[model samples]
Target: MLALSAWAAASSRAWAQAPMEPHERDLYEAARREGQVTWYSAQYSADTSEAIGRAFTERYPGVRCSVVRSTSQVAFQRLSQDQRAGVAQCDVFASSNGGHYIQLKRQNRLTQFRPVNADGMLPMLRTADPDNYFQYSSLGIYLLGHNTNMVSDAEAPKSWADVLDPKWKDKLAVGHPGFSGAIGIWALQMRSMFGPDFLRRFERNKPQVGRSSIDPVTMMTAGERAVGVAVPSASTLFAASRGNPLKLIYPTEGVVAVPAPSAIMSNAPNPNAAKLFMEFNTGPALSRITRTMFSESLRPDVPPPEGCRPLDQVTLLSPSLEDADRGVPELREQWRDIFGV
Candidate 1:
C-alpha cells in the first residue's frame, strides 16, 4: 500500500510537470520579468479591454499591460506622433489594414520577431518579411445590416444588388473609405463589382455618409437611418445589447473581407512582454469570446459564431494587399468628389 501510494504521488507530479505550449511558456517567462507592454488597438470597449487586461495579469502575475484605445488610423497616427516626439508609449499595434502594415514595414519600423505558431498560418498570409511584423486575424466578411425599426428581416434585402433599390435611394448609410479599413474594402468591392461608373451611379442613391465608418452602425441602430452598407458584426452586437434592433445580412454575391492584423512595436520597451502580448492576444484567452462578440476568431482551430456564414462559402470580394495599397489613395479622392464631404 505504501509503495502504491508513492507511485501514485510520483505519477501525479509527473502529470503536473508537463510543459506548457511554447507561447504560453514564453509568456510566463516574459511576465516574470515584470515589464510593461502597451497595446494600440481600435478594438476598445471598456468592459472587454478591462476583462482581457485583468485576465492577462492574473495569468502572468508579474507583467503589466496598458491598452491605448483609438481608431486604427488614430493608432497609426499616434505611433507616428510618438516616434516624432521621441516618446515611446505604445508597444504593440493592431489594425485591419494590410496597406498600413506594408508601409510601416518599408519604413523599417517593424521588429523581426516571429511567433512560435506562425508556421501554421496560411501561405497566402505569409508575407516573408524577415520580421513577423504583421500577424493577421482569420478573415471575416463585412455585413450589411438593417434597422429593425425601419425594416423587418423579411423586408430586409439579402444581397448587394438589393443595395441599389429605389426605396433605399439616398437613404443608404456607409462609412467613409479613407478611415475604416473594413468599409474601405466595401469601396474596393464596389469599384471592382460595379466599376467607377458604379460610384457615380451610387452617388445618385445618395448614401448618407458618416465621417467614421462605424457611424453607419450607430445611426442605423438608433433608427436614424434604415440601412448601413457595412458594419462590424461585433459592433452590431454591441448595439444590439443596448436594445437596438439591428439585423445583419451577408450579401449573396458576398461581401469584402478585411484581415485584422497585429504587430509588436520595434522599439517596444519590453520586447519579451510585447511578444507575450502577441501570443496571449492570439490564443484562447482572446479567441474564445469571438462568437459572443459578433466577430470571427483568428485561429483556424476555432469555428465561427453559430448562425454566422462560413467565410469560405461566402463569395469573396476581398482585395489583395498589393491592389488595396495601390488603389486606396485614388479611390479616397474619388469618394471625396462623390460625397463632397
Candidate 2:
C-alpha cells in the first residue's frame, strides 16, 4: 500500500463539499436508499482508492462507497467472473486499460450515463468513449524512474532505449503486462517505438517483474532495483515526497499518457448509487483527493499534482481506442512468452 502522507490526509479533510444541483440531489436521494456503491477500481493505489471512497461518503452523508482495489487485469477478471456467475456486485468499474471499456461496451455490459460534472474535466481527457459509456476518471504518465541514491542524475537511464544497455543488467524493475493494464499499454508503446523484439531485448536485462505498475516504484524505493523500466509517474513522485530516493525521467521519445476511465455497470444492483458514484468521480472532491496523492486531476479547477508538469506541456503518446483494444491483449500473451511469468 502507498502510505498516505500527512499532507494528503489534511487535504482530504480540508476539502469543502460543493452543493449539488437539483438533478444530483435527486440522484443522491435515490442512491441513499440503495445505501452504498461498490467500486472495482484499478486506477489508484488501495489507500488512495479508499481515501476517495471515504471522501465520497463524507460528501454525500448517506451512501457508502465500497472499494475493491486490484491491478487492471485482475479487477477485470473478477468483474468477468461475477458476470458469468450472474452476480451484480460491482456498481462502478474503473480500469487503467481503456480496452476493457471497449470490450464491455460491445457486449452492452456498461451503463451509458453522462455525468453533469464531465464539463469540469480537462477538455482533452473528457472523451474516452464517444457514446459516453466511460469517462476518463484519472490520468497518469508511464516513464522511466530511478533510485536517486543508487543512480545519480548523470548516470541514470535518460530514455526508453537506455534501460536496454547491458550496464543495467539485473538492476531493473518492471510490471507484468499480463496483470497491469497501464503496463500492457506501456509494453505496446515500447513495441511500437522499438519493434516486436523490444521485450526480448528488455528480458536480457533480467528485470524484477511485479504484478502492478506501482510495484516498480516500490522496488526502486526499497533499493531492490536501481531503475524502473516503465513506472507510473504519480506513485514515483509520491514516493519521492515521502523521502524515498526516487526520481522520474520523461523519456526523450515521449511519455505514455494513460487516461484511466470509469463507468457504471448495466446490471449494477445499486444503479442510482452507481450513477451518483460516477458523478462523484468526475466531481471536485475526488479531484482534490487525487491531486493531493500526486496523481492527475480530471477537473480543470484542480491544478496538476505537485512535482509534475501540466499535462498540456508534456509530449504525450497514447494508443487509439482501436489500437489499445487490439494491442493490449496481444502484448499480455507476448509478455508471458518472453518473461515466463
Candidate 3:
C-alpha cells in the first residue's frame, strides 16, 4: 500500500509539472493548420523582432510568424486603425506601454488565454490583467548611454543632472514621449523626480529627438550624438557587442525599467497560433535570445547579460500603472511645448 501511494504521489507531481494539457495539444494542431501568426510589436527593433519571429517559426514547423515592428505609439495606432476599420490583421500585440492593454481590455479588444508557461515565470513578469488578457514579455532599462570613443570614462555623466549640462548641447540624443513608450515612462519618472521646470531647462540644450528608444544608439554609433538620456541598456549592450562603442550608464538617481506586455487580439484571425506564440515567449526556449539582446529575462532562473547588473541589483524608478496612464498624456503635451517636436 505504501509503495502504491508513493508512486501515485510521484505521478501527481509529474502531472503538475507538465507544460501543457490535451486541450493545448488541440490548440497546437489547430495552429499548425492555420500556418501563420501576425504579430504587431514595439518591444524591440525590426531586427530583434524578426529574430523572435524566425525563432517562433523554427519552433513550430509550418507556422510562420509575421512581425510588424514600430514604435509603441505607432504600433498601437496601427492596431487601433485596423480594429476601427473592422479588419483586424494583428493576431498578437506587444507594446512597452502596459496602459494600451488596459484600455484594450476595457473595450473588449483583447482575448483571454493564459499561457501555460506563466506558471514558471517570475512574479514580477506576471502583471497581466486579472482575466489574463496580456502578459509582460520583455524588459529594458531606460537611462543614460554614451559613445565610449567620444566620451572618455572621466567625461561620462553619472546622474540625471549631469545630462542637463550645457556641454552636451546639440550633442545629446533622446526619444520623444509622443512616440516611444519607453520615453513616455521615462518622462513620467523624470517629472515625478524633478519639477516641470526641469524639462524646459533641459530643452535649452537642444537635444536631438527621435521616435524610437533604439535611435539614440544609432545616433551615437553614427557620431551624431555623444550622449543619450533615453537609450535602453539592452540596445547599448547589443551595440557594444557588435563593436559600436556604446555604453550604458545607470544613473545615480535610478534606472527606469520598461516592461513590454504582449496580448492576443479579440478579433484575431488565427487564435490558436497567437496562443502558441504567447507560449513560446513565456516558455524556456526564448530566454537565451532575450539574454543575447541583454534584456532582463522574465524567468528568474535566467541571469542577465554579462556586464549588465541584474534588475534587483539596479536602482530602478518605475511608475504605477495609474500614474503612467494618467501622466503620459500631460507629459507628452508638455514635452512638445518645451521641445517643439
Q: Number of the top candidate by lDDT?
A: 2
- Judging by TM-score, tell me the better candidate of 2 and 3: 2
lDDT of 1 by residue, 1-341 (tens): 24433543453344235556866786668666856778886653444455456556656667877877665666777888998999877777876566777888888887777666555444444443445677764354577888888888888888877787777786688887766666666787778887777777777888888855578888897677898887766666667766778877888787677776777777877778878877666654454444445456555665665446766687767787767777776787888888796
Clashes found in each candidate (C-alpha, N, C closer than 3 A): 1, 0, 0
Worst 10 residues of 2 by lDDT: 1-10
lDDT digits (tens) for residues 251-291 of candidate 3: 89889988778999999999999999898788655665556
| Per-residue lDDT over 77-154 for candidate 2, one digit per residue giving the tens place of the 0 to 100 score | 999999889988999999999999999999999999899888888888777788999988888789999998899999
- What's the lDDT for residue 244 in model 3? 84
Between prediction 1 and prediction 3, the one with superior TM-score is 3
Cα error of candidate 3 at position 21, Å: 7.0
Show where candidate 3 strays beyond 4 Å. 1-24
Better of 2 and 3 by lDDT: 2
Superposed by TM-score, candidate 3 places the C-alpha of residue 64 at a distance from the truth, in angstroms, of 0.9
Clashes of 3: 0
lDDT of each: 0.69, 0.88, 0.81
Structural similarity to truth (TM-score) of each candidate: 0.84, 0.96, 0.91
